[model samples]
Target: MIQAQAIRLFTNRGYDAVTVADVAEAAGVSAMTVYRHFPTKEDLVLIEQPARLIAERVAASSATQPLVLRVGGALVDAARALTGGDGDAPEASERFLLDCLRLMVSTPALRARHLDSQYALQQAIVDALGVDTTDPDAAFRAQAATSACLAVMHTALTRWAQDDGQTKLPALIERALTASFGDVATGQGD
Candidate 1:
């Protein structure tokens, strides 16, 4: 409820124009309550669930598989899960997601924080893969694979937002991954 209020206010009143207290009041909660849930204003708009879901999917893949295959397959699976089976979120949900993406890309502060969130997500992927950072080569490989997969995701999402969410996001994601890593990305072969 707080987040919905925040997004409503942010979208209608502008992110800079609305304060946490405003959102709190709009949601019938105290400022402290809002702060307890979202440490930063950006957190009100940014969601961490996708990263967690992606990491979990990656971790569930067999460790014996090649890194690209594991990460790519996990990314594809995560993308599907995010948009639902038909590669489309409900109309209302898609609008909400697009609004959040627009806010993140348009706002300078949110753009910077989005990068930071990506770094944290990369670390989560590394940990999920159980890569030993003590081994420099392993760390480098894990980081590279994870970063590449994330890059594909970002590109697809950017395109999705640019198209005003008319295009199916999962298809865009699969296309980007396939272009970057070929058939291995589709789980056809390593």
Candidate 2:
């Protein structure tokens, strides 16, 4: 409810124009409730909850599978969980997600906070990949995988947003990852 209201407010009024109080009122709750739900304004926009879901699933994923498979599968799970129940449009949920994503990407104030949100997920990926901190090569591999996976996620999301939420986000994520990393995943790249 807080998230839905906040997105509406942010969409109706620019991110800079909205406030905790504004979202509180829209949600029919007090400022404290809004703050309690989202530690910061950017959290409302970033949908950190969903991101956390992906991180948890990814970090806890079975290591027997390929890294790309695990990351892509985790993303798919998270995206599918967004059921678009906000009563706006069929694309409302994804559109809202895309709006927040765009706002975070373009807004400098929000961008920094977005990075802070991503750090934990990145670290989770690093740990899940079992990168030995003492080994420079292992650390680089982990970093490279994290960077590439993030790129794929971003590309998929951006493309889905551009399409006005017509495509299934998870499918786009898989396609993007496959197109960009299939060779590497299949051990065919030199």
* Highest-TM-score candidate: 1
lDDT of 1 by residue, 98-153 (tens): 78888999899999999999999999988999888799999999999989988998
lDDT agreement with native, every candidate:
0.86, 0.74
Candidate 2 pairs with clashing backbones: none
Global Cα lDDT for candidate 2: 0.74
Clashes of 2: 0
| TM-score: model 1 vs. ground truth | 0.92
In model 2, where do residues sit more than 4 Å from their true spots? 83-92, 183-190
Considering summed lDDT, which 10 consecutive residues are worst modelled in model 2?
Answer: 83-92
lDDT of 2 by residue, 125-161 (tens): 6776665699998788767777778778878877876
- The deviation in Å at residue 119 for candidate 1 is 0.3
Q: Give the TM-scores of the predictions, in the order they appear.
A: 0.92, 0.80
Report how far residue 162 has shifted in candidate 2, in Å: 1.2
